[model samples]
Target: EADIYQTPRYLVIGTGKKITLECSQTMGHDKMYWYQQDPGMELHLIHYSYGVNSTEKGDLSSESTVSRIRTEHFPLTLESARPSHTSQYLCASTGETQYFGPGTRLLVL
Candidate 1:
């Protein structure tokens, strides 16, 4: 496999609820990334971390937050989800090469 996995491939929830998108990798990579994408649009890098205790915001605006406390796990959380937050969340980790998980599609109404 590609060494990356995301849980809850699809989600639909009402507005004003907390949600978390889980991302995990088995490659023991130090560089992890989370991207948001809409249908037929380019992926926007929202969050990234180089290593343990090293996190940085990417070149995009996002209401989500991520944690890289472990080398192979990066999870994103939204305090309160909204309709605007509906999008596809993709997680990736760089080994010798970059590998991306399938993704999680979330819909908030």
Candidate 2:
């Protein structure tokens, strides 16, 4: 199995609800990243961190927020999800090559 994990591989939710997308890596890599993507499209960088207590916003604009207080856990949260928020969220680490999770596919109505 890959080093990362994302639960609720698929989700259907109504508008304006808080949601947290889980990302955990067992590889023990210090760097982690969060990306959003549309089906069969390119991945958009949204959030990333070099290590614990370190965080930075990526090139893309996103309503989601993320934290890296723990070495192996980096989760993304949306205070209020909208239809525009609907997309796939991918998590990766800073290795020679990124190891990605299956992704969390969310659909907001």
For lDDT, the strongest prediction is 1
Tell me each candidate's RMSD, in Å, in order.
Answer: 0.8, 0.9
> In model 2, which regions exceed 4 Å deviation?
none
Say which candidate scores most in TM-score.
1
lDDT (C-alpha) at residue 66 in model 1: 89
Each candidate: what lDDT?
A: 0.93, 0.91
Model 1: lDDT equals: 0.93
lDDT tens per residue, model 2, 1-109: 5678988799999999999999999999898999999999999999999999999999999988999899999999999999999999988886777889889999999
lDDT of 1 by residue, 1-109 (tens): 7979999899999999999899999888999999999988999999999999888999998999988888888999999999999999999999788899999999999
